[model samples]
Target: MWQPFEYAPKNKIIFGKNSLARLGEITEQFTVKRVAIVTDQGIIDTGHVEKAAYYLTQKNITTYTFSDFAQNPTTENVTAGVDFAKEHQIELIIGLGGGSSMDCAKGVNFLLTNGGEMQDYWGYGKAKQKMLPMIGIPTTTGTGSEAQSYALISDSKTHRKMACGDPKASFRVAILDPSLTVTQPTSVMKATGIDAISHAIESAVTKRRNALSASFSLYAWKLLNANFESMLFSPENEEANMGMQMGACYSGMAIENSMLGATHACANPLTKNYGITHGHAIALMLPHVIRYNADHAQDIYEDLCRISGIVIASCAGKALARRIEKIVAATELPTTLSAYGITADAINNLAVEANEEWTAQFNPRIVKYNDFVSLYNKAL
Candidate 1:
């Protein structure tokens, strides 16, 4: 039986090498005046901010820069950004880095235009006012925030990640320039690449998965699996870089159509409790979650394994789990929670937090706190 679904595609994506050239024209289409570019200090240090600013300068567009958000942005960060944008009377926004920068831009947009606390808009489509138009240029291939309507912000008070979303929050345009990603250091590359791969894998069997969304995840899997190694081992491989970016973007699209699963559900508690980088936390937990889901979701996993041209070792679900662990290890990222010094005592608390995360509800299989506890122990 076919499941009912809804699809509303909102993003206009411009992809290629040096696609950043179109920023001025895109902003002109929106009649942008003064603009704010939201990103991190790393991007400015790497000269991407200057490069983007130069393009705006060519068209006589004035700009403000905000790089004040954390890796997992906080409500305070968005509040500060909204104040900055308001003080400057910025007319348009550009997010010019990884997920953090893009998400921060969306966070700012919510409070700047809508005039409310971040908590007021914690779920989907809560904004009742017009949103300032924004463009997202991903300097790294992770997070896929550019392609989705949700902003993952952390509550400064609770330290819990919040999924604040609205149609208005989705980027007006997403610029995927492969050249921009090639300059990232190996650590950034590995971490973000794993995140993209996880999106491709996890979104495939979520309860919300539909045929259209599944197509995106499956193709994303093929691209990421095929290109990930080349992008890592062969520095500046333009073709490989393009594949990874496209894969990540498609995976983002899948996330928009469906949602993530228990891997993310299990991953979040690690980040919340241990201050682990989101990517590494996800990498540590995903293999175990994959194995856990496979008891019911094996066909989906095997299909992806086959489509990605990976050998399903002995035609068993456990092989797929081991393969995921191998990929994480090959990236040289930690594959165990213990690597980060998280002790057994942490599992009980982490599982409780995981149980509360909304993404766990979307897992293809039913997940409970006990299931999270088991998954965390296996990850350890």
Candidate 2:
């Protein structure tokens, strides 16, 4: 018999080539007037923030720009953003970049209303009160922060990344425009696309995986697998761009319901320590993690193999590992930690940290500290 589950907080999804043009209409739905546009310096450099601010200005909405967020948003950055929001009496937030901006927006909302540090809401459903309305506009195809209720925030002191979530932190609307993604460089596309693929694969094999989540993951995996290579090899193809955007969004939706597994658990520390992109870290660790999870989640791995069209018939765990290596090769992503300057000692420390990560609890395999150590050693 199948177990029961509840869906995530509902969201309004606006998707298309130029869906960002509807931002004003969507923000008005929540009766927002003064808005805080949370983003990063890179986004401002790309002029995406200016474009979003223009849209709000055209609608007669006052816009406040908060583009000081870091690549991995820290508590201090979030606190500063919250102070800015409060100073302007901002009624709405528009997250106008990748995961960092959206996460900073969520952190600002949490600190603004909840009256505490970002660490105060590190776990699940910690916020007891409501938050301001947020609209997320993703400029990249990865991270899927626009669709989820959680934010990945880092501790200022320890540099440990925390996953903060509350039902109220869920976005009121997500504007997915492939045109916005067109400005992303080849490196951004490669990293973020791999991150989306990891989300699908991890969600499908997680302990929380259910029928509803599996359906989303299957379709997301199919779309990502079908279009990732095309997008990488043929950057000018409109169809490939659309598929990547849609697939990334679907993977985000899947993670909203089922969460992620060992790959994310391991990747977080790599980002925190080495300053690697989240997707790049995941890609470096994913194939090895997939091999590890397959030992315990054989049936689910086989299902994913069939869905990804990686294997024609039943295959052993090694085959899945090899397929992931092939995918990594096609993307030209690093398959080993050594290529990224991650040494054995760092790997050991990262293993300790990864073992402590919240996502480790959802891994299909019972991940002990030694298991993390082994995986890190193997990845290196």
Candidate 3:
């Protein structure tokens, strides 16, 4: 029998070329007067924060913006955001950038309402109190943070990334304005796109995957694989941008239901140790993880290939891995771990850390320390 699963979508998604104009209208639904927009310096530079503030202010809502977080949001950053929100007595929050901004927003909500450190809610559903209603407006086409309840916050001291989640933390609305993504640099586009693609593929065959997540994963893979190259080559194409945005959102939704696998588990340590960008680290590890999981998830891998119109070669897993390699090649990112200056000696430590990542347990195929070591060596 199929595993029993609950399919409840908490976020109402609005997708268009310029749905950002509806931000004020959407905020009004919560009947909140004081609002906080959590974003990044880069997005503020792009004027999206100003545009969002203008819309909210026009509706007679008092607006505040917090952009003190780094690209990988830390617990200290969330604490700082909480202090800022407390000072202003903010009513509602709008996450208005990439994953970092959204995650920082969620992390703030966790503490703003339910007073505690990020580590208190490390696993899931640990918040004992209600969380403030928040909206996610993504300016990038990846990370799918808009569609998730979890906030990936790094610990300040140890630099460990924590996935803190609760039902109350899910976004009330996700505004997908493809136009916002056009302003990103080409390198950002390539990295985030690859990250989204990994989300779709990894979520598809995880141990937690069920019917609901499977549908999302398959469709997201189709959209992402079909449009990734176009989004890179013709960044201004509305159709391509929309496809990538929706694909990334769907990938996030899939992750919400199913979680991820060894690729993310392996990628996290690379980001923490070497400061490798998340997407670039994912690119280096994903193909190897796919091949590793083939013994148990080959059928699922084959399904992804079939849906994306990729003909399987001798092995479905190998074919999918090769396809991902080809997609990575299209970008300027290096495919090998050594290219990032990650030496062979570091593989042992990276493997140990990878084995301990939260996503490691959910990998369809069991991943041990030695297995991670092998995967790292292969990537090297």
Candidate 4:
């Protein structure tokens, strides 16, 4: 029997090679005068923010810049953005960067509208007031934050990243311009590209997955899994970059409909403890998680192997895991916990946190603290 499911979509997406050119026109759709451009210094330094600002400026729109957020946006970051928005009396916002910039934009929306802090809206559907209409302009092919409603803001004291979300907080429009991603550094491409792949694989077998979410996941898998090798070497290829952007965004849609699983559950603990990048953390543990979830999700794994043309090395799950491990290696990222300098003694502590993560509950195979402990050991 099929489980009953519901899908809710809020954002209107505009995707193409030069979608950023329509920024000014998109802003005109909403009745707003002052607009806040929420981004990070890295994006500003790249001149992408200025390029986006030009479009709005041409339409005689006043724009205020707020670029104080970190790569992993924190409560403090969102708070500062709220202050900026309040001071500027921003009637709208434009998120023009990668996941960090877009996530901060959603975070800013949470507090600016609801009269509370980021931590207050930590769960889901917590907003009460209508948020400022905003446009998302993603400059990378990772995280797919543009396609989702949740803002992953880190707690100031505990450092636990909160998935703060509300339908109102979702971007009114997402403009995916592949040309913007061409400027991304090779390291950024690897981290974000792998993150998309993780989303593709994890969403397919998650307990909350439905037909809609599975289709998005498989489509994402097909786009990204097939191009990993070529994209790594030909990062500047226009077609490959376009496919990766769509792949990441499609996986984000899957996450929007369903949710992630143990790889995310394990990765969060690694990020909090080791200060490792989120993509690197997940890439290290995802292969191990595939093996962990394999017995229960064999059909799902086999489906990915078939659709993505992954060669099976005797076992559906193990083969998929091995294939992914090789792909991660192509990025030259650290794939083992030991390589990251994490000690054997820390597995218990890490497992405790991993087990407590909300995503852990959705793992197709029930995840216990011991399972996490063992998985971390294998990654080591």
Q: What is the lDDT of candidate 1?
A: 0.89
Residue-level lDDT of model 1, residues 1-380, one tens digit each, is 58888888898999989999878878888877799999999889988899898888888899899998898999999999999998999999999999999999999999999998999999898999999999999988777889999999999988889999999999999999999998888888888899999998889989999998999999998999899889999859999999999999999999999899898988887788789888888888887888788778888888888886678766535777777777887888877878899899888999898998989989989999899889988878
lDDT of every predicted structure (CA atoms): 0.89, 0.86, 0.94, 0.90
Task: Identify the leading candidate in terms of lDDT.
Answer: 3
TM-score of each: 0.98, 0.96, 0.99, 0.98
- Give a tens-digit lDDT track for model 3, residues 1-380: 49999988898999998899999999998999999999988899999999999999888999998999999999899999999999999999999988999999999999999997999999899999989999999999899999998999999999989999998999999999999999988988989999999999999999999999999999999999999999899999888999999999999999999999999999999999999999999999999999999879988999999998889867899999999999999997898998998899999999999999999999998999999999999999
Assess candidate 4 and give its lDDT: 0.90
Q: Write the per-residue lDDT of candidate 2 for residues 1-380, one digit (tens) a residue.
A: 48689985568898988888888778877777899999888888988888887877888898999988788899999989988998999999989888889999999999998888898999889998889999999988777889899999999998889899988999988999988887778888888889999998899878898888888888888888888888888887778888888888889888988999889989988988888888888888888888787768787777777777676344545676787677788878777889899888786788889989889999988897898998989888
Candidate 4: stretches off by over 4 Å: none
Best by TM-score: 3
Order of models, best lDDT first: 3, 4, 1, 2
lDDT of 4 by residue, 14-72 (tens): 99988889998889879677999988787888888888889988888899999988889
Model 2 ranges with Cα > 4 A deviation: 312-317
Clashes of 2: 0
Q: In model 2, what lDDT does residue 31 have? A: 76
